[model samples]
Target: MEVTSPPPSLLLSDSDLEDCYDIIDPPLTTSNDGSTVSEDIHKSMDEFDRLINLDRARRKMALLNEETEKEEEKK
Candidate 1:
């Protein structure tokens, strides 16, 4: 698959980015209220985290591959 870097201006707004961060690193809650979090919410959050991790890893690998190819061409 071809991976292209996004333009800087295409990035999410600060507020939206913060929301994502909050979901990935939720605040510590001491309340054990039954209505705290539903099973579906937990599942969705987990799925989002997995997707984010996979995307990050793929980007990193693409960058490394680019660097490797450049080095090989220089050899």
Candidate 2:
């Protein structure tokens, strides 16, 4: 059987590597169907913020309840 050589990237020079960036890391662009992409991203961000705030509030309430319990125990 014949031996095949390695791919072009393995043999690339520094300048060649720089020029190959388009192939390596292509540009990211949302499709132009509608405002759905931006709206979806915004919706996701809002949901994430809401969840984070909810968690923080729960933790604060728990701490407050613990303090109240300790104060009652001391009385």
Candidate 3:
């Protein structure tokens, strides 16, 4: 008898992808000792900061677009 492996395409699902994302992008945590931060927690905080900056930039762009449209209307 011989053993065979399934195709790569059949091995993963949406849940698996979400689990991977959660592992890579974990929730942020703050240190209680005020001494040092864990590497995983630091990484999570960095990811969070990046997401917040991106969101702020998106909102600023939208506001700028609205302002530009208003100026166009004044012409």
lDDT of 2 by residue, 1-75 (tens): 999999976798887878798578754446575555556788789999999999999999999999999999999
Q: For residues 42-70, could you state the per-residue lDDT of candidate 3 as single tens digits?
A: 67899999999999999999999999999
Q: What are the root-mean-square deviations of the candidates from the true structure over C-alphas?
A: 19.6, 6.8, 10.3
Question: Mind sharing the TM-score for model 1?
Answer: 0.51
Model 1 lDDT tens row, 12-52:
99999899988998765545654334555787899999999
Backbone N/Cα/C clashes per model: 0, 0, 0
Rank list by TM-score:
2, 1, 3
**Model 3 segments beyond 4 Å from truth?**
1-37
Q: What would you estimate as the lDDT of candidate 2? A: 0.83
User: What would you estimate as the lDDT of candidate 3?
Assistant: 0.83
In candidate 3, the residue pairs with backbone N, CA or C atoms under 3 Å apart (3 or more residues apart, or in different chains) clash, namely: none
State each model's CA lDDT, in order. Answer: 0.84, 0.83, 0.83
TM-score of each: 0.51, 0.54, 0.50
